[model samples]
Target: MSAPTISYENHRFPPQVIAHAVWLYFRFPLSLRLVEEMLLERGIVVSYETIRRWGRKFGAAYAKQLRRKRPSREDIWHLDEVVVSIGGRNHWLWRAVDKDGDVLDEIVQVRRDTKAAKRLLIRLLKKQGLAPKRIVTDKLRSYGAAKRDVMPAVEHRSHKGLNNRAENSLCRCENENE
Candidate 1:
């Protein structure tokens, strides 16, 4: 499929410069002024306000293009669950990621049991439209039980070390809950 094109009509800067600014702003954890400084360092003069405008105008097109790519059936999914505290209560955040560490899906639920695991697996299957070649997770018995019910044919690997990809995909804020 062809990639979606972003229009840069009536802009003072070239398409490359504008695209770079927007990319820098979204691709990193940088503030708008930081992005402005980054552009200036590259000999491109642009205001942070202009950069913000370009992001607001063109960011959706970039995001849409990214969301168009689908997970492959050959992908090995790494699944992990973390406990997070919200409003003085504990919640489970189930997350799945491919070998490349791209998040496939995530859900926040009250329980971290077999039912929750099944829900995450079902969501992943429906969204990806295919079962992964294999699934890896920590030594969580819920994963094993859920996999048997949701996708009994796929290979399941349960090991703490093997699930680092999914573990790293979790945000630092969730880690702080421990």
Candidate 2:
């Protein structure tokens, strides 16, 4: 029996530089080719394809690591839904956030009914391992029913201007997607 050989090539620039180059590409609206040109100016010439690969590999890894390190604490969770278009079909983005504006969970669903709202809440609670003490939501009747079904003990607030935090978070996500 024979074993396959593994080889590693050391990069000319440090890992941090390569990681930063990829991070800047996604953190802004610039195209990959534009990022390549910017890196060229810094005396580190690399192709756009290479940068794309690095970003896909490292960006997701970094995000996952950062999420794992975050603390899970019980707090007020603001919940909201926004209309979105996916593949020419209307969808809704259900989002939950903490009082300090940290995202707890986000899910895309085909409807905004009670069942959908319940599913979103269950997913968020399961993933975060904590039920919100206070849930702030818009005046969506579905939210009232969902809260009653899934978390009857949790306080629910549904005032017109009170859910601005979650609404603003949805707007930020929408703007970034655009």
Candidate 3:
């Protein structure tokens, strides 16, 4: 199914200006006021609350379009898991990244067993519509176990040093959350 078209009716600013403001706010880590200031520098006198409203109205559609524009799947995938504490409870964050260090998929689950790993693999494979030539991960036996059942023909490289890309991606995400 296709995404619904965004309506730009009943707005003072042109569609281009509104779209640019929304893009600036979501495509970067800048705050709403920062986005407002940047737009003001361009002589577009708009309120931060207006920008926030546009983001709330159009953010998901913009993100959906970006996801639809993903390039071809990489040949190698790096899979990793990390434990995170939330509300005094522990949850496992399973992530899959391509060779270029771009996150392909992620899932948060309570368990980090073979079943969880398999779920990640299945979701990745379904989303990508193709299995990578190989997958690298830490010395996690669950990954190996899941790989056998999900994509047995794909190569599995289990090494601590080989999966720094995935580890670093997780680190960056955690840092952003803090």
Candidate 4:
């Protein structure tokens, strides 16, 4: 498949500069102003606002293209979740991985519940385009509830011990600021 073209119409800076700025902003945890400062240090005078706009314009397409290039993934899925603090707020990150530890997909939310579990399942279904041959998750009731509703036909192995594959991948967050 041909790669999606990025449009650089009507921007004063060259396409490479705009693309690089957008890439820096999305490819790292740095804030928009930090991206601005980094570019300024490199002798580029673009504003943070411009970097933000570029990220908004091009980030999703770039991510989609990259995902498309990834090889087809394993059918056995191990799913797990952990609580993380981002910007002083608690968030639950649900992640899925194959047995070999390649990340399949992940989602973050404020609540860890049936709805959140279902959303993760739906997203996995949509993105991977195939139901897993088997899903292994911890003994969370929400996973059972979601699986019954979302993909009852697929085999589900729920065991706190069996899901170590997914759990080990989490690298649980520790609050270092304390």
Q: Looking at candidate 3, what is the lDDT of residue 109?
A: 98
Q: What lDDT tens digits, residue by residue, belong to model 4 across residues 1-178?
A: 7776988889899988887898888888999999999999999998888888889888888787766334343478899989989999999999998777778898999999999999999999998887878899998899999999999998999998999888777753223333
With a 3 Å backbone cut-off (N, CA, C), the pairs that clash in candidate 3 are none
Residue-level lDDT of model 3, residues 1-178, one tens digit each, is 7778989999999999999999999889999999999999999999999999999998888888777445353579999999989889999989999887889999999998999999999999899888888999999899999999999998999999999999999898879999
Once superposed on the true structure, which residue ranges of model 3 sit more than 4 Å away at CA? Answer: 1-19, 22-43, 46-74
True-structure RMSD, every candidate: 6.6, 9.3, 7.7, 7.8
Cα lDDT of model 2 by residue, 1-178, tens digit: 5333322246565786777786788778999999999989988889998888778767776555445434344588899998888999999989998888878888999998999999998998788777777999998999999999998998999987999999888778779999
Worst 10 residues of 3 by lDDT: 66-75
C-alpha lDDT of candidate 1 relative to the true structure:
0.91
Model 1, range 1-178, lDDT digits (tens) per residue?
7765787889899998988898889999999999999999999999999999999998888778766456677889999998989999999989998898788898999999999999999999999999999999999999999999999999999998999889887864357677
Weakest ten-residue segment in model 2 by summed lDDT: 1-10
CA lDDT, candidate 2, residue 87: 94
For model 3 the local lDDT of residue 17 reads 96
Worst 10 residues of 1 by lDDT: 169-178
RMSD of 2: 9.3
